[model samples]
Target: MHFVYMLECSDGTLYTGYTTDLDNRIKKHNEGKAAKYTKFRTPVKLKYQEKFTSKSDAIKREITIKKMSRQEKLMLINKG
Candidate 1:
């Protein structure tokens, strides 16, 4: 299954992304292999995630979430 995931960084920051392997993806983030934005934001925790049947769907959800304001993202995170 694909996943749409949100991470809370050690610096009180938030990041939204998607991957098929949640564990590996988090590992990559920790190891600075995920994205440049997250590279310096080490020790990120997966605060939220949703499984999807398709990668496209997962990516679409990620895009939608990324477009949201931080407050709205927090609300969504709280709701999840």
Candidate 2:
């Protein structure tokens, strides 16, 4: 399975991405080995996650989430 995830950074900002290994991906972000955005915003927490059977679906969902406003993202997290 793949995943589309939202992370709340230490600075209260959000980052969205897709990964096959959710736990390891979050670990990499905290360890400063993931995306550049999360690297600077260390100590992120997983706020939301959605499972997908295919990588393409996860990627598409990630893109959709990335395009959303902060408020929208917050709503999505709340719903999750």
For lDDT, the strongest prediction is 2
RMSD of 2: 0.5
Q: Candidate 1: list runs displaced more than 4 Å.
A: none
For residues 1-80, could you state the per-residue lDDT of candidate 1 as single tens digits?
A: 99999999989899998888999999999999998989999989999999999988888999999999999999999999
Per-candidate TM equals 0.95, 0.97
Q: Which tens-of-lDDT digit does each residue in 1-80 have in candidate 2?
A: 99999999999999999999999999999999999999989899999999999988888899999999999999999999
For all candidates, what are the clash counts? 0, 0
Candidate 2 accuracy as TM-score? 0.97
Model 1 worst lDDT window (10 residues): 54-63
Please give the RMSD to the true structure for each candidate, in Å: 0.8, 0.5
In candidate 1, how many Å is residue 32 off?
A: 1.3
